[model samples]
Target: MKVGFVSLGCCKNLVDSEQIMGVLRENGHEIVGDPRQADAIVINTCGFIQPAKEESINTIFEMSQYASKLIVTGCLAQRYEETLRSEIPEIDAVIPIRDYGELAEKLQEVLKDAGNGSFSKSERALSGNPWSAYVKISDGCSNRCTYCAIPLIRGNQTSKLLSEVREEIEALAEHGVQEVTLIAQDTTKYGLDNYGRLMLADLIREVDRIEGIRWIRILYMYPDEITEEVLQAMKESSKVLPYFDIPMQHASNRLLKLMNRRGTKEDVLALVSRIREMFPEATLRTTAIVGFPTETEEEFQELLDFVKEVRWDRFGAFTYSREEDTPAWSMSPEVDEQTAQRRLDQLMQVQEQISLESNQKKIGQVVEVLVEEREALTGRYRGRSRADAPDEADGQVIFTSPREIEPGTFVNVRIDEARPYDVAGVLAE
Candidate 1:
């Protein structure tokens, strides 16, 4: 049977989709990229926020039109399995995140000839860039932020064993993956649940020992959990990229408390200062939530000020989404949608200026970029430097290569122009 897969949401969900594909392939099922060509289509849904939920639901409907047997799995399925099954008669199977271990059997039940192979937890059918992959170090979130639905959807944090994580990366490295971005709901909290202590640094050291892997990046380092040891491990490791993706969420001390975040405004500032002090060339990326419940004009201004002060190399902001069951859902003085969107726009404008200024500083600098693609119309190569992650929020280096450069090859490019979110340059002679 042919199986089509549609992975939605974050890179964490992408890992799950990859695992599902791996399971299907092991069971002798052919994986098809197109829904029209498949006997059944598996849709990995995301329910992190209202907009993401709507997008997931809409995707399910769109895939249903192809008349293929539809299977829904992931956060949305985990959170609203009953609602989806009751409402959508088209769905054949709805597997939540908890049942991912039994994915083979679930598919067998749905498609009689789907085979009886057991789920391979470690196997992944890499979907995106062949040279880059996202390795989920852990799952779920223990922090239980007031505005976050991750805990309700995916439960608490569960880190993979250090050996297991190493094995996965070794396999990826053997398969020609040069860069692996370690990701989780909170990567800093890795190993606390099972190992009794934070083991991200140890994990980094272990991965650094692996051959064939060139760049190792870690994302979602919670501000409070970023220890000196972790930074030192990154500094000492040859493979680990000096990129920090610390999600601040908000800058106001009061809002941080309300959101159940562990750190205060001062703590975050100090962390940024400490990181810059240690590695002046390190790439600092962060995210902020613009409008939360009871967020005042002063609070938003504080966040804006923080962005200006820190000048993140890459930054992203989101408007608050009031989801039910979360603590912030019923909080009084809710920020109206209009006000929230306005604040989000205002925050982004400030970030745009900061990003432009930051990028401008890189002008004339020769940076090593991992070439990814070529623009169809312009015929110029596009790629990212160590400072940029493989995401929409990060900037890209667009350059004219004298010779055609293959994707995944690293090359030095001299940046000549800077934009708000990207840079243009020429391949270095």
Candidate 2:
């Protein structure tokens, strides 16, 4: 069978899609780059919030026209199976996320007469963008924030075996993947439920020893779980990039409790200060939720003030989603959509100025950049520095080059100009 896959949402979703592709190819099925030429189309989706859900739905609808059989999978299907089936009659099958292991067998049965899904997994190479990859050390969320529905959808946190993560990293390195981002609902919470200790530092130390992997990044770290030891490991390990993606929802103690988030505003600020003191050049990224239930104007000001003081290198703001079955859904003083959006806008505007200033500091400085691609019309190469992640985070380093630089190759770039979200540079070699 000739099959195509469209992965949507987070890096975690992409990992799932890669596994499915790996299995399908092992069964001897042909994987096509073009969706229109495939026998079936599989869409891995994300249903975290209202915006993501809408985008996933639209993507499924668009792919339906190109493939004969449409399979809906991932968080959205797991969360709203019946709703999706009823709303989108074009889909032939709906596979929940947890049951991904059965995909190869299901494809065989579905396309038996067509001889499309009969390949073995070992024959197919582990696939996806080779420059960067996402390694999910664990699945699900243990933190039951009042506003978040991840725990409800993904269940309690379950850490993968230490050996399994090491093996996966070895496999990714063998496939020419240079940078791997360690992801989980809460990365700092890894190994707590199963191993009875926070083992991210140990696990990362092992992955750092693997050859062909240059940069290691950790995401979704809860503030309370970020210990001094974790900071020390990041500083000491040559492979570990000094990138922290801590999601501090708000900067007000009252609002923090109302949102069911652990730690006070002071605790968050102190952690930020401590991280900066330890790794001055470290790039800190955070996600903030605005207009949560009962968030007052003064509390919003407090958050704005924190942003101004800390000057996070990267930041994103999202309006509180009144998700069903979540504690914050029924809370009083429910902020209207307009107010939430306004607060989000105000927060981003302030951060934009801070980002501009931060990027400007890189001007005329020499930094290591990983060349990802080149644009023909622009006559420049596009790449990312250590401070920048693949997407979501900031990306820069477009400069004129006499020679082409291959993806995944590291080169020194001298920053000549900087913008709010990108920087211009020339190859230092």
Candidate 3:
């Protein structure tokens, strides 16, 4: 049977989608790219907030047109099993996330003629660019932030044992993966539930030992948990890129406290200073949430001022989503949708200038780029530098060369031009 899989939301959820496809393939199902050609279609969804949940629902309905059997899994299924089953009459099955291990059995029950075959549990049949992959170090979130429903959705942090992670990395390395992005709900809190202390620094040290892995990137690190030890580990390792992806959320200490985030405004400032002092060349990326409950004009100004002063190399912004069951859901003085969106827009405008400055500085500098693709028409090679993560949400370097280079090969590109989110140049000797 041809099964087309639709992966939605964050990279973490994408990993789950990969595993589902892997199990299905092992159970004698053909994985097809086009939904129209599928006997069944499975959607691995994201129910993180309003926007993501809407996307998941829309995707399910869209696939229903093509698939004879429509299966919904991941966060949306886990969160709204009853609602989806009742409202969406076309949905054949709604497989909850917790029962992912039993995916093969579930499919066999619904896809009768598709046959009965057990999951091999060997390895994931990865999707997307073969040259890049995301290695999820842990599952779930321990930090119960006031406005977040992650703890309610994914439960507590469960760190994969160091040996297990290393084993997975080994498999990925053998699969021709050149770059791996370490991801989790709270990556810095990894091993706290199991090892009783932060093990991210040591984990990097271990993963860096893998032979075929060229670039190692880490993301979703909680602020106030990015230890000096982690920095030291990154600095010492040749493979570990000095790229910090710290999601501070907001700049006002008062707003942060209300949001139930760790660290004060001064603490964040100090941490950023320390990081820049230690690794000046490091690519610092961050994400923020604007228009939290009761956020004053002064507070919004504070955030804008901080962004201008700090000048983050890469930045992303999202408006606060008033999710149900969260502490802030019923909180007073909720910022209206229009106001929240305006704040997000204003914040990003500031970031655009900062990004332009950061990229302009890269002009005339030679950086190592992991070749990702070659444009058949333009004959230009495109790839990522240390600043870019495997997620592709970040920037890339598009360079031209007389010699032929493979997708996974690393080449030095001398940057001569810059864009807000990309750079261009010629391949170096």
Candidate 4:
């Protein structure tokens, strides 16, 4: 049957959708871009935050008009399955990630029961606008942060075997996928539960060996668990990008404890220093949560000062959102919505200045940028350098070349102009 898959939220969810797509293709199913053309529609959703949750629901409702069979899967459905079924009448069925194995069979059953139309599921080409693809190394979270509901939805931590993950990377590389971002709830915690210790370094080294894969980036690393071996692997691997995404939710030790985040302010700073010392050109990316429940003005300022002190190359900060079943959901002294928003704004304003300064330093230098695609608005092409990731992080290169550039090809671009979040350049001749 013709199946349309809508992948939502983070890269982890996209990996789930891609795996399901793989299964569908193996079963000779056709994947369609438009829901109207497809026999069924599958929505892989996010339940991480209020905005994401609402977006997922709206997407399902919109697709329901033409889709005869609507399958809602991924985090949102996994966490709130019954609520979704009761509220959304257009949804034919809700399948969580655990039950994704039934996808092809369910599609057949749904299409067969609707006797009005004939259905045939034939494998089609992989269609996406993505310049880079993500590979999930693990599922679920053992960290259980007070503001996160991931563990409740995804269950216990489960790391994919080293060999299996390498195989997946090879498959992606074989399909002409050049940049593969490694994703998980907490990447540093990968393989600890199953392998008796961490093995992220090993897994990444193996992936780096795969031919045709040029850029390897890792994301969602916890502050406390990044080992020396991992740092060494990143430094030595030619394919591994010199980028680190360490999530330190709060800077104050007291606030960190409340959020169930490991490491003190000193610990985090030390790690950052160590990373910078090892890879001088490394671009550090991090996320922080402001205005958590019981957070004081003094504590918030501590975080702001930390940001200034660290001067992270790229970073994002958000106001804490109360999530159900999480430890901090019922905590007293909840910061007012307005107050939370204000803190978030103030923090970002500071980070913006730091980011601009960092970008300014790149001017007049030639950096390797993976040419993603030609921009529709400017008629010039857009892509990212080693310092930038695909979306949340900044993209560096806006270059004009005499020759047409493919999406996965990497070329050196000279930085001519710099902005807070992006850079403009011309391809180096």
Which digits, one per residue and each the tens of the lDDT, describe model 1 over residues 322-419?
Answer: 89899999997988889999999998999898888888998999999999999899999999999889878798999998899899999999999999
Against the true structure, candidate 1 has what lDDT?
0.90
Q: How many backbone overlaps does candidate 3 show?
A: 0
* Residue-level error in angstroms, candidate 2, position 76: 1.2
Task: Tell me how candidate 3 scores on lDDT.
Answer: 0.87
Residue-level lDDT for 214 in candidate 2: 92
Worst 10 residues of 1 by lDDT: 113-122
Put down candidate 3 lDDT per residue, 1-429, tens digits, no spaces.
899999999999988888888878777789999988999998999999999999998998889999889989999898889999999999999998777667777877887645343333447888988878898899889897998888887889999999989988888889888888899998998899999999998898999899899888899888789998988888889888888898889889998999889998788788889988988888888888988899988999999999998788888889999899999999988899899999999988888888888899999999999998999999999998888886646888999999999888889999999898899999999
Of the two candidates 2 and 3, the one with more favorable TM-score, higher being better, is: 3
Note each model's CA RMSD in angstroms: 1.1, 2.4, 1.7, 3.4
* Model 1: how far residue 45 lies from native, Å: 0.3
What TM-score, to 2 decimals, does candidate 3 have?
0.96
Ranking by TM-score: 1, 3, 2, 4
Kindly indicate the candidate among 1 and 3 with the higher lDDT: 1
Q: How many residue pairs clash in each candidate at the backbone level?
A: 0, 9, 0, 4
Residue 136 CA error for candidate 1 (Å)?
0.4
Better of 2 and 3 by lDDT: 3
Q: How accurate is candidate 2 locally (lDDT)?
A: 0.83
